[model samples]
Target: SQRVMETMAEDGTLPRNAVRIFWSSPGYSHCCFTSQNNLDPKLAAEIESAFLSVTDEDPIGKAVLEGEACRSFVPGTDIGWEMIEKAAEAEGLI
Candidate 1:
């Protein structure tokens, strides 16, 4: 979950700029997310499918697939009041 960790470090949640797909070890792949916000469901599903298709039998691939699935289910920030607060905080308009 290095991507997730990185995203969290940059922004408090895993949002559009937080998640990414890349090769971790040889044929194995890794998907990391530092935040989950404003994620498109269709795109998420496609990414999930891609992760699942990796032929490498490495644990990193499995972990990436599981992480993708978990992230895919997360509702974007649009549905919550917390995002409003965050927005206000960002604009210094709170």
Candidate 2:
């Protein structure tokens, strides 16, 4: 990712010497799904499964995934979230 940024800067899409990657915390999702706590467990499982089932092989799945800039969905986790939270707080984004 940093290489891509540097290449862009070289190509003049971004100002040279202006690009800096202060922080990066991979494996942390930028968005999430939530439902009411009262939602039925079975229905919740179904919803989760449906999301995880999407892949680039199916035409509709490919379109949806590409539109959202996502490759595929995996089980959610809070891993690496603390670093992201700290970075966001430092930037006053949260």
Candidate 3:
């Protein structure tokens, strides 16, 4: 992805691909994957809602959302990494 975007910038292809080849969700800027540049507004809204629902419900999804706000995606309440670590330590894994 880095190399592709770098090539895009070097070749002045970013703008063209942005509006022509790819579309991002309004809710998430870095979430840049779309089947069509001209996705229907209604469908986009539905997709966004689905994405948000997953983010809201799943523990790992919460970590993703938090990481989106911050920087790196580290384990926390979402997925209970701390609890897992404690269990592992109890079993002498750490």
TM-scores for all candidates: the values are: 0.25, 0.59, 0.28
lDDT tens per residue, model 2, 1-94: 6766877888989887676888866644646776767999999899999999999999999998887667997777656568877998999977
lDDT for residue 53 in candidate 3, whole number 0-100: 60
Worst 10-residue lDDT window, candidate 2: 25-34
Among the numbered candidates, top TM-score falls to 2
lDDT of 3 by residue, 1-94 (tens): 5445766877998854463435543432343334455899899777766654655357787787765553433221233256766998999967
List candidate 2 segments past 4 Å from native: 1-12, 15-23, 78-94
RMSD (CA, Å), each prediction: 15.2, 6.2, 17.4
The 0-to-1 C-alpha lDDT of every candidate, in the order given, reads: 0.54, 0.81, 0.56
Cα displacement (Å) at residue 77, model 1: 18
Model 2: per-residue Cα lDDT at residue 58:
100
